[model samples]
Target: MSQTLDLSSAPAILFLFGLSGSGKSYVGNLIGELTGCYVYHADDDITDEMILALQEKRPFTNEMRDRYFPIITEKILHLRQHHNFLVVTQAVYKQRHREYLCKNIPNMEMIFIDASDAVISQRLTTRNGGITGASALALRRDFEQPDSNIKVILNEGDKSMLVTQLNNYFSSAQPEKD
Candidate 1:
């Protein structure tokens, strides 16, 4: 179950959606490396315009997520045409995202990296330079992971196990012959 995917036409989009400090970015990168696919992070604002827009919007809401999800969806679809496959990470906790992606995408799989609130808080607090009670509370409240077509990796103290599980999940997602 550890073979590379043959993605010649359009690269399948595997959206890694999980809570903050849940290692979506890190895991996405690792998966990309293992599968030889490019890892795309939608959160980065390379362009100044997008930054200004996000800033003006202020505190992120479900409403903003609703409006912004489409832009990335379209982008991923467009990117698949050129590359063999793409691995993207997003922080989707709402039900609509799960529904929309499953409906529209030809081959899409959502992997929810499950981690405890304590783990997430610890990771954030250590890495964010500084952490606040408010941010921790926000994460607890807002990390709404959709449970459709999801493969959960038990994110405990075992790093190797998590990686193995992720690799297996990708292998399963790729088409198999009888």
Candidate 2:
């Protein structure tokens, strides 16, 4: 038996998570375009203080993340009320954080986006702004890899391959005739 992600019956909320420069945002945007769901970048909820800390090469402490999760949860809940389906991008590196979001949201699916260190480095070099270099490395060092149960999408330097994989993973199913 083959597992299929039926876009027609996709969850109310979808989360794309991984390291910075791993292409979570790109994947989330693509999913939104394909499914016509609203896309939300969780970074948008980042406070200026968090931005400064990141800019100063400081990774967020679990306590900080704990406080942060509620804000994101609230935003997601608000967005859920308006959109039938939603795609969200966040570097939910810790399993606890993923669990927190999952507990608060209904019918949500989380997919991990992965890439080689080389690919991440190359992508970071071209990025205009956002977490990069030491900041990114710190996050990677602190990242708690999700357990085997979570789905993984490898994005190794090829946009076409990524697109093909995503397209294959999510397919629209036609309604059955009576």
Each model's total of backbone clashes: 3, 0
lDDT of 2 by residue, 1-178 (tens): 1333346545778799999999999888866665577999999998777888898898888878888889999999999999988999999888999998998898998889999889999999899987777899888888989889987889874555665565455546444559
- Tens-place lDDT digits, model 1, residues 8-79: 433377777777677788777866766688788877622344345334533356666667777777777787
lDDT of 1 at 101: 72
Error of 2 at 20 (Å): 0.6
Give each model's whole-structure lDDT: 0.65, 0.83
- Runs of candidate 1 with Cα error greater than 4 angstroms are 1-11, 45-59, 128-133, 157-159, 172-178
Candidate 2 worst ten-residue window by lDDT: 1-10
Candidate 1 TM-score over all chains jointly? 0.73
Best by lDDT: 2
lDDT score for residue 45 of model 1: 22
